[model samples]
Target: DHGSQYVSDVFQDEIAFLGIKSSPSYVREPQGNGIAERFVRTLKENLLWVRHFDTVEELRLALLEFKETYNREWIVGRHGYKTPAQVRKEQTAPVSIAA
Candidate 1:
């Protein structure tokens, strides 16, 4: 799957040369890319929806803050109220294998 930026000839060529398969969701099928769409909506609603910025730098800083908070503090219902970083840490923790 490719973002709009990845649709460029250079990206397509690189993926092709690497023997990687690439496909884009059909324009009208939001469900095909539901997870990404949902994230965008969440970001807008929780971070960008009520803010106004005069410069790209300001927007960048705001996004950085938003991402840090979202990853470290925001409780997501999907993860049983754990923050994304917490859930990721739990998932990646080492597991002992029984002999």
Candidate 2:
């Protein structure tokens, strides 16, 4: 999102520090955010909805495990049917932001 909170310098610094890519969809273009939206849906369906955690630490651990499993096993069409780990391993293109 290009919303104020997301675009704020504080938020951007945190994202950069964490080494996560910050790619916001073009304004008013929901289609551009499809991948992220799909990820949230998948997370809820595969983990959140089906599991219960008694504590935040337990949930965090579960999420960490889920991330590893997802990156290693999930085949995504957008990545040409490759798991995220595969795609990342093959990635060599330079990163850029579009205006």
Range of the 10 consecutive residues with the lowest summed lDDT in candidate 2: 28-37
- The C-alpha TM-scores of every prediction are 0.66, 0.71
Q: Pick by lDDT: which candidate is best?
A: 2
| Candidate 2 wrongly placed segments (more than 4 Å) | 9-23, 26-29, 92-99
| Cα lDDT tens digits for candidate 1, 68-88 | 988999898878999999999
Candidate 1: pairs in clash = none
Residue-wise lDDT of candidate 2 within 40-59, one digit each (tens)? 99999999999999999999
The 0-to-1 C-alpha lDDT of every candidate, in the order given, reads: 0.88, 0.92
